[model samples]
Target: MHGTETIPVRRVRDGALDLLKWLALLSMVLDHLRYVGLSLDGLYVPGRLAFPWFCLAIAANLQRVRGAPVTGQWRYLGWLLLFSVISEVPYRLFIEDADTLNVLPTLALGLLVARGWQQKTLFDRGLALIALLLAALFSSNLMFGFFGVLLPLAMLLVFSRPWYFSVLPGLVCVAANQWQVLLDSGNLVALLGLATCLIAPLAGRVLLRYAQGASPPAMRRWAYALYPLHFLLLLLVRQIIA
Candidate 1:
């Protein structure tokens, strides 16, 4: 009965994680849809859902792993590295004027930072430092890739603390949204991005509550592939329509 009871809890968590992930993916697709079909000036608004949702997912995983044996945690990092390579070229080809490094690289590095902070390991500490430096140098071309690296850490902080403390990540997310930079375009989309980043996490916390369950193997396995695949598919659609 104990084992059986645990299964339901695990299913609930995994189900919730998968649900939030799919929602984030859909938001990202809609955001990218602007690149292909609509070009709605406000398209970036919903697109804001992608990064923070991904960050919360990472934090949720970390929380799940909190007491688990840490020996094989690096395996997760390895999988991320594998997909980052797979995703890079397709990502570059799909987005016009996109920076060289893609989101997976940032997510990969962010995972290292979060895991390192958890273990307090010397190797991870060094790696985290190197990752931060690389993110800073590549920031301009990567288009907020560095901010993406910081995002997991931000999520971890918020997850570790109370609701009132959420202001910390909220500020970082807003700053990273580059409101001042967007001021030049004079487009309201930037403001929309800011609002989404601020509010999304609050909703995310609630969504995360239900993320308990069995391993989301199918969803987890497919998600990394979808990152690059979606971009390429959207690019094809855009070309055909054009």
Candidate 2:
């Protein structure tokens, strides 16, 4: 009998990720603008679109780089770290309720979860478990952090499945986006925010169908710039209104 060898499975490329990242960036900008441009009106509905998309983007990146070298992942994480530091002061200045730690910390922790699960390293795995427990316990305060930790596993579950299977993770992802409203003490804006999260991913998935593997480095860099720039601009506007 001929010896059998296990073939390494390659993950399929989903264009939905890039589309989702761009969309999340847009939603985040809109959300931030409400703080700066229209704080009184409660326009958090459309802004709710950002966080889930960003989490999805992190998941997509982890999926693509699963078997690749570690150095690149480290480098990408470095960029995020740098930007998170760069954006924090401005972010704090811009939002009334801005926390000491912003979304980047959550994203970074989520990256650890994804990389740890993908590599199955003892240290990474242990750290991820710890992070997960912490995030779950403190989800109300660490919304993005909690979502980030769970996002990779969710992506892995649906990574190679048909679109129908994705529905399960998609719902979980949306639920993560606006879960506060699910509680008995809820309001109209929170309900609308939940609706927006559910619908936004559909647009992302459709865009990915046509634009997979088409984005260039220039566009990606520009997208990063939008995060801080938008915050600064909105802050300026908010100051004007005040």
Candidate 3:
């Protein structure tokens, strides 16, 4: 009798990617706490890591879906768009002095650019071009500005190319931030913030490539609720503390 063979199945969900998402979420929360009736000025340095890590996560997801059905990609963009609208009021309420719109819009645009580059479809390219033009027109009005939309594309490029090529996008990430002010301050926290912003993508890439042993809970569609809900929760906390 021939014996039946069992092949080991690879995991569909990546623990390292989930961990990166959790880190980004936590960093964003800590960053927002600075405005939530706390003396958390020191949180700024860690906050610098949030956006780049989120962009890296997007790049990782895009790479994962490279040869899969395009519907998943559209669904991802739909979620970002929905949350971008839903989170705005809560974001504004939570951050009184906020000048630009919420971060989700930037992420959505970034997704378009990354997808366009990956699929190279005429429709995708057209959408990306429109997003780029919109980003340029509203550079000052978008959270993280235009470079924010480009950061994910840069990260996608980094993932598809050699490792050392990450620095180019790292510089772009730094430029998206308030680096000049940090440099002008010339403090340890400021320097650390600059370093974190520049190295976030590289660190995320390393984690994605080597941290397969980790099995953290995967962040899924429900994670979208966290964005607006976090702001509401923080608002309640602030009210209670007050």
Tell me how candidate 2 scores on lDDT: 0.67
TM-scores for the candidates: 0.85, 0.77, 0.93
Tens digits of per-residue lDDT, candidate 1, 1-242, equal 56556433443346777777887888888888888865575778888878788877887788778777775567777878899889888877877677457777777878887877876779878888888888788876554567777878888877967777766666666666776776566667776778788877767777766555524444666677888899999999988999
lDDT of 3 at 201: 83
lDDT of 2 at 242: 84
Candidate 1 residue-wise lDDT at 97: 75
- Best-first order by lDDT: 3, 1, 2
lDDT of 3 by residue, 1-242 (tens): 34787777865888889988998999999988888787988899899889999999999999998998899899999999999999999999988888999999999999998899999989999999999999999999898899999999999987978778889779989989977988999999889888988888888888888888888887989999999999999999999998
Question: Per-residue lDDT for 157 in model 3?
Answer: 89
Clash pairs for candidate 2? none
lDDT of 2 at 20: 71
Quantify all predictions' global Cα lDDT against the true fold: 0.76, 0.67, 0.91
In terms of lDDT, the best-performing candidate is: 3
